[model samples]
Target: MGVEVLTVSSKGQIVLPVKMRRTIGITDGDKLAAFASDDGVIMLKVVKVPTVQDFKVRLDEAKDWAESVGYKEEDISDIIKSVRLAKRENSN
Candidate 1:
């Protein structure tokens, strides 16, 4: 794609060209993460924020997999503590 100049409106918003938007697969209501660098570079990235339902679905899937693998809920704390201890020892 060639370079396309964009003009910012008085409201400090720039309209992404339809062609560019289509190429990048950006749609309405999508969230964008914007970053500005010291070198005057600006970037926008599409980011997904999981909804409560999405998180619940993922949690349910994880629970189902853990149950299928015979992992009980009581093992989580020990597993996390062991991982943290291992990480602390490795960092030292």
Candidate 2:
């Protein structure tokens, strides 16, 4: 891991050093998840938001798997409710 000192601008923006950005594969227009702690520690993580096409692809895969496993459409609601009830009981 490498450390680089950064100064936050008045508008709450900070420029990541070129070396750090290159190492982490960060480019212009990339999204980052920022986390701040009560102790003043801050962390940044690269995040990718899925497009609608991506979500549809995943949904299709899930539907295919459900069909192959013999899970009918009518069974999903009962399965979800039972799972939620079990979780609530366990948490208590």
Over 18-79, each residue of candidate 1 has an lDDT whose tens digit, in order, gives 99888888899877655333423334445675555654565678779999999898887786
Flag clash pairs in model 1.
none
**Model 2, TM vs. native:** 0.46
For model 2, state the Cα shift of residue 62 in Å: 33
1-92: candidate 2 lDDT, tens digit per residue = 44455798999988899888888888988877553334243344446665556555656787799999999888877876787787777679
Error of 2 at 59 (Å): 30
Q: Point out where model 1 deviates above 4 Å.
A: 49-92
Report the C-alpha displacement of residue 53, candidate 2, in angstroms. Answer: 25
| lDDT (Cα atoms) of all candidates against the true structure | 0.69, 0.69
